[model samples]
Target: MNTSRILRTTNVVLLLMGYQRHWFEKTSHRFRLSLPSVVYIFVLGVVYTACFSQHFDKSSSTLKVLKDISPFLFGLIRVQLALGAKAFAYAIYSSVKSVGAINSLLKALPSRNSQFTQDEASAYLLLTSTFGILFCFAAYIAYEMKFELPPLPDAMLGMALLLPHFILAGSVRLYTVLSWLSRGQLKELKKNAEEELRANLTKDPGNIASAIFTVSTEGLENLKTKLEILEANFCIFAQSLKHSMLFLFAMHANCLLGGFYTLTYYWNTWYVLFEDRKRRIFYAANASIYAFIASDYICLMVVLFMMENERRNFIEAIDLLLAQRKLFSKKLRPIAKDLRGVLKKKCFKFGGPFQPNIIYVSLMVCLQIIIVTLIVTVHYLEDEISLLKEEFSSTDDN
Candidate 1:
């Protein structure tokens, strides 16, 4: 009963938040914002909670599995929580800035078309904001289920490790929409930048400026949507960064889950079968599994690396505009410089708010790796070795 109430509350909250975000986005299909993807994942999570909550004790094994994995899962999730909170702050800033940018650009641009027919921009913003909201809800559930909030640990770790991945899957969906919104803008920017650079190099085109975009031609509703899109740039930036970490965590979970499930299945066999038992075998398997599991982690780091590299490249690219920073339309270059500075600093300080404090986080991370390798061995190695043993016996008999 309590569970049901909580779920109902969650449902209402999601609906309300989704509604507000949609308003920020100035969506035309106002009726449809009610059915965001967050609602779906929310419903699924609620249903899952309800189903499991009823027979909580009767289903010990399954619950146990969840409990076992909860710690590491919670650790990873806390990081996500921190990221989401940061994203929310960014979104708020972007929403206000986007509105300002659009208004400023509208008043500034006399030649460029102010009337945009398509509202892909709204869709992009809507998807991005809703994704963040949904992810937060999902993370909350994970933190509660896995950690001390409601006190359901055990196999929760698996879910914890897995929750980010699952959330990421949803985020990827939003990214697709954002990629569409960015398509034309990216091309337009590139073309203008390239042409301006060429013209300048040839004749030093004395302070060439690109065009401003606006939607003054659209209706009030469309204007609102454009306003949302304008703010959504920062939202999109934060959203993009958040998804990256999600992707890394998900990949790590995938490997961990793979290894752990294998180990669980072959746990009994190791007791009777081998001297070092399945422990040694599992360790061997962990190495390979860890590689696959961490592959995504590696990819995640690389993506961030590349993003940072691009920022640096942009700073280098705009040498001509550096002198006119005050006159330039955007002011994010300063922030970009700060971000780049942090990345450049090779000296990683140990104790700080920016970095995590929990020593157990490190332990769980290592443990997660070890467990993953063993699980992999159990799943893949035993069968192959068994087959080889069989073949040898057959040869001996012959």
Candidate 2:
């Protein structure tokens, strides 16, 4: 999949977006954080403040006035919140990198040339990067069309908005790529561990206690060391992403909530547009905005769910190995003890005790979609439902 090339591209893009430094830059060839990163963030802040400040003016359009009163308040809140979160995360990321944690973690990562085919990985990378970029652009176009801002201001706002959309979309793609690739690596490791265990057990089928002895102590210790390193690296990765992951979760939630409210509030206007074939473009664009939001949210939730599933499966394999600890000699018992310690720890941390199970997260996402759907459906059918009730009453009278 040309991992080095992809990594370089990602580093360049991230630095341009707004970061103190790139996360996975090569040791031999580093990309230094320069003045452009700060300038970009500064420009973004100025653009956001200038745009919103004008919108808040009493003489401005009704749309601007209404934005303050509506759920679009979240839209305003999100920009500021995102900027703050990004800054905080970048600070943390920079500190983590300064201490060499990032480099160590990068080194600990399994080879890209594992069991997952390069062609398949490349396809996924291409698909995700393309979809994220296109979706962001589509959302921007849809927003611009739906709002119908004046030319100069519209162009300026589009420039301001488009950068963040593209940058954040790229960030999301990067996260998903890492998650799935790590999942594949973990899966490969688990498979190898299982095969080794099976082979060891085969040599002593009648005596479970003798299996550990059948495998060379050196081989067992090597596997133990690998797991130890894996656990440490996984934790470092999670720690590095602690703030950023929370920010992403908040962003997805804010978008979904804002989108749902926006759709419901504007349904009547949109329905009118829908009824007019000539104005259907407006309706289609508005719908696409929400579609992009829902799709992004669901895409993230599904990938994380799959990653968690693989993590749990791997943990269970380790647990099975630990279960036969009494059979191991003193040398191997220490390995079992360390494995037990790893079991006690969380694989991924998402800011303190906020770790959510996949089922809970999936259900919450599903519920949001269903609720948004119902809101649109009920509003669309409101007149029909009223007529049906009137007809039933008249028939009863008759």
**Which candidate's TM-score is highest?**
2
Please give the RMSD to the true structure for each candidate, in Å. Answer: 15.3, 7.1
231-287: candidate 2 lDDT, tens digit per residue: 677566555554554555555555555455556655644455344543554445556
Cα lDDT, model 2, residue 358: 61
lDDT string, candidate 1, 1-398, tens digits: 12122222323443333211222122221111233544554564564344334334556564455446444433434454344334333433333333333223222111223343343334333334434554554465455345435335434533443343434333333222322333333233334443443323312223323311211222322322432342344233334335343444545555566456545544644345445533554445445544444433333333333333443454355454545554433333343233334323321111222221124234546776677666566645776687799999999999
lDDT, residue 277, model 1:
32
Q: Which residues of candidate 1, in runs, are more than 4 Å off?
A: 1-32, 36-43, 59-165, 172-188, 202-232, 235-306, 312-398
Span of 10 residues, lowest total lDDT, candidate 1: 23-32
Q: Against the true structure, whose lDDT is highest? A: 2
In candidate 2, position 78 carries an lDDT of 44
Candidate 2 regions with alpha-carbon error over 4 angstroms: 1-6, 12-20, 27-101, 110-150, 155-171, 198-215, 269-278, 315-344, 348-352, 363-398
